[model samples]
Target: MEAKLDLPFDADKMLAGLQRWVECESPTHDAEAVNRMMAMAGRHLALMGATVETIPGRMGFGDCVRARFPHESREKGILVLAHLDTVHPVGTLAQGLPFKRVGDKAYGPGIQDMKGGTYLAVEAIGQLIKAGIPTSKPVTVLLTSDEEVGSPSTRDLIQAEAARHSVVLVPEPARPDGGVVTGRYAIARFNLRTTGRPSHAGARLGEGRSAIREMCKQIIAIEEMTTEACTFSVGLIHGGQWVNCVATHCDAEALSMAKRQEDLDAAVERMLSLKPTGNEVHLQVTRGVTRPVWEPDDKVLALHAQAEALAKRLGFALPHESSGGGSDGNFTGAMGIPTLDGLGIQGALAHTLQEHVQISSMVPRAKLFAGLLQNV
Candidate 1:
């Protein structure tokens, strides 16, 4: 086998395709917007002669899109995982984050945090088709609708489809140093609520059992759960209607992240074991999203090694990093399948208004992806 294969990737063409995807904003919770985005992506895949399947949206999310490049065999193959929905809400493009190029960087809401990566997958596949490169296995493309929100609606579908593949490639986004992600932290969220009796603070303060006070104690305890391996934080909180009245209810959302499952389980056990400190105040905790850790097992490490070698053939060191953030790759990795992430275009400032993709890296990265699709 040759060290380097000449795979054509047009930077101008990829940029235009990525811009079109960026302009079609698909927030996780907006079914209509994400459906529209899925429709556009389907058209592109259809044009590539792929058999596209549009799975209706479930659990109140946008539709999930799947495209298959069938080979001679109907056996296991490569699964290209991507998410169509973004963290940005509707009207974000008009809020000073419109798709624009300032120098070599292209700014947009979903460009960096994965619309660019998704389009890179499309272009890479297109190049493979145009070059008439033959593969031993088919290539499957899955663009889910709810990855930004922990893939609540698409988790089962992702896992089910990934089970049928030999390898999974997730084009999430390269790290700041253009490194691919080898492992990702496990994430869990919770909704906490406190109940107490309401009373006038000025006249009946002694009789009021303040829910705010109860929640403050819980917050402190939750903060104490943080460590180098495990982190906990109260991201959202709500309580109290009037300042002169003792708070009767308080609600908060908490998040926890850990590098290993044992650590996450320990933290969750502690959170569920929390008891109210104040008398007559009640506490309730509900578990929300829980994504298992994607530890870099031997299979995943081997995949990374192959990716690194491939990048070297292209004249660059493809370093790998373990990320604190999670992606749909976590699902496949946790399922014991060989999964590699950060296969997307290089970019920075994901999930922020300053999110952008480096224009110059598009072709080379797309070439890298094409090489993987053919070589893997």
Candidate 2:
């Protein structure tokens, strides 16, 4: 006979909890705002009877919340990873993307990208506690404050904590096809700056070397370096202070992603080898935080297979694939731990104004998460 799992929380309660989180607006750069979000999550975990700790932030990032659920044994258990930070800035809610439900979609900042998944995962545990259901092992939930910015401050902490766990589950928003992530591509960030001589635009146009012009040329070159093995794009750029004067300095940020580590290494080398187009201007390239390629091994595949079975029992097909965007799973999976990712809410248009989660998917996904907690 097939077994049954009953969840104590319903869709209405889950949506209400998720709306509170989406309204908080914890952008990654704003440490105080992220801390507020962390505080909220910590309180929820505490109420669920989990031993919670708020680790102090470092390197200008916000604090991290770690909560270990009560269990009989102290043996190695499961790690549920999530991030509270988002790419959207403050006032985004008031200006646009206010939390609202329309048809089967609920739209808001960070709702689909992750806040929904994080809330549901915690709710699953909370409901399990309410139902007096015990998991196979202890569970640890780590909610970090910086991830959209590459997780620079929390990478070490992630790896260290993951080392103490048997398996890692990352709820980073389900795939567009409602699949999970088994492997992740490698990612690298670059900081580029160009320096040039400045002069009065109206009086001495020919005498000045425009840093903005040089930076534009460099950006084109960098993007043109894309190949089937790796891809590059310039996302953020800043230049020119005065309209009447030639720009003296320009700075930009670029990102490259690769399916293989060697390809990323070559791409990094090429980015650093950039040269100034003109003798009057200087170009400099600096590498930033990187996410190592996570290729699934036997252990990861086995864990994914377990989720597949659980998903099947829950009356859903759980397909998985190697994804491009990196998550904290990239860190733990690359460490050879059994890791499964994209176990979050199903939605589309992440990191955009139209970001949303399928309202109907909330209860089903929460039940799936609850099943994994008990069976995996």
For all predictions, the C-alpha RMSD in Å is 2.1, 1.2
* Cα-based lDDT at residue 300, candidate 1: 87
Clashes of each: 0, 0
Clashes of 1: 0
- TM-score, candidate 2, is 0.98
- Candidate 1's TM-score reads 0.93
Candidate 2 per-residue lDDT, tens place, 121-187, comes to 9988888888888887899999998999899999999999999999888888998877899999999
- In model 2, residue pairs whose N, Cα or C atoms come closer than 3 Å (at least 3 residues apart or on different chains), thus clashing, are none
lDDT of 1 by residue, 1-376 (tens): 4323587677877788788999999999899999999999999999998999999998899998999986888879999999989989999999869999988999998998899999998888888788888654799999999998788889999999999999999999988788898889999988999999999999999999999999999999899979998999997899999999999999999999999899999988988888888669999998888899988889888988888888887878888877888899889998999998998888888889999999988887887887787777
TM-score against truth, every candidate: 0.93, 0.98
Specify the poorest-scoring 10-residue window by lDDT in model 1: 1-10
Query: For model 1, what is the error of residue 345's alpha carbon versus the real structure, in angstroms, after optimal superposition?
Result: 1.8
